[model samples]
Target chain A: MHIATRMKTRTQGGITEVLVLVNHPMDTGLVKSPITHKIIPAHFIKTLTIAINHKPAVITDMGIAVSKDPLIAVKLKGAKSGDLVSVDWIDNEGMTGHAETHVS
Target chain B: MNLPRRTFLKQAFSGTALAVAAGAGLLRPTQALARTWPTWPAQSFHIKHWRDLEHSLFGSKPVVSGGVHLHAPLEAENGAVVPMVISTKLAAPKRLALAVDHNPYALATLVNLTPHALGFFNVRIKMGKTSRVRAYVETADRVHTVDRLVKVTIGGCGG
Candidate 1:
């Protein structure tokens, strides 16, 4: 599945909120492959990590039960709007994708 | 002619009994409801469509609150790709999930957020037709749901 991400930042109560959007198929082992006429094996991003300035901000572990092209939002401390936040994710099939956003 | 009278009486009696049996509760209803409701056999898109309103996800319950917001196009030109967004106003959220009804399998995606992250997300989804998009949120030791409808003009999922 093709993946892409975008992030937005806002401040509340002295904390920065980081929002993210990711593009992916996240096939849940139910869709059939047209050529094979067989169920496409479950392959999806199982883990997602958000780091602010290379520090661990958030980590998420997912399963096949999730929807396609999942979107995630998070809140972090010590980061302000207009700061750089990095995101990295790994799927069950061992494929990895990364993205970055300026906190705003 | 004498032999025919007994046969006719017996036939009449049996017919009356059969009619009575048919009218009583012993017979099943003539019009049975179809069982087309969604079902999840193996937690996939083809078996059951995800519904946040129904609270059918694993390890989560459905709640309604102002913190959860879901956005999608009122009408989609292509079911193959529909844009969607889910945002929350909660202070600290633990988990977020999205489900689509009308696809072969309903549970479309799940997003787990970090402890120190804002509650906002955006993504693209595949739709089969006009379906309900549900957002599931876990916070304050409970689960909540917010839903919106999306209409698809073109068939997706290889339909």
Candidate 2:
């Protein structure tokens, strides 16, 4: 998979906390050839969608500034152990990446 | 040239000695001490106020800050990538957005929310330079905002 996700869900006092870490280069287009000195056109994720049970939960727009392999943490009050949580991202170059896992 | 003798002596004793040594032709300037220059976008980012940013991004100015907490680092090691999080006590938000006041595009993202958020959200955004990041959230009733300054290291935009 182009995107690998690590996620976990824990329920405590009726609140479910979701932790996410996505693996990607998140290239900010800042690096260029030492010889040519051309700008390394920024290539990074633009949109990130978090959905629970196929319903959109949180949607974020990313900038060229996000670091490689981003981390996201959220707390969902009513989510359970079996609900399906999906994360999807679209890069600036239009390349899309996605991954899904169950809350446990 | 305006440096005091003690300062010059300190630099001469410290790292600037190489630049001094280069002047004497004792050594060639090395890449180890090469300078890295940061470049802001050619077009300047201009916004008169946070309300202006809100008006441009969300159509109307927001209410005073309440119920929303923005978590971010006080200082960022790199300007290109910064970590951000927004948490709130609102029941059901209609949308939320993040903005860096000095970025080429201040409005980073505005997401239509679901009741599922339970008021906590996280994401990472890039900062072209050091600036205040404001998080605005619109619920069924009103809008709330929270902001903080995030300092950046020089030449961090991949100079």
lDDT of each: 0.65, 0.68
For residues A25-96, could you state the per-residue lDDT of candidate 1 as single tens digits? Answer: 777675788899999887776666777775546665554544466666565776776677877776767666
For candidate 2, write residues A1-104 as lDDT tens digits: 46776676777887877777878777656577577888667766666767788666776656554567778776766788788877666666666555677877
- Worst 10-residue lDDT window for candidate 1 chain A reads A58-67
Off by over 4 Å in 1: A1-43, A53-78, A81-84, A99-104, B1-62
Candidate 2 CAPRI grade: acceptable
Q: Write model 2 residue lDDT over B42-142, tens digit each, in one string.
A: 22123435556676655654466877889999998877567788888777876777778776556665565667777777777777678898987887667
* lDDT leader: 2
- Which residue pairs does candidate 2 place in steric collision? A65-B80, A65-B81, A65-B126
Instruction: Provide the TM-score of the second chain in candidate 2.
Output: 0.62
Candidate 1 CAPRI classification by DockQ: incorrect
lDDT of 1: 0.65
| Top-scoring candidate (DockQ) | 2
Note the B-chain TM-score for every model: 0.63, 0.62
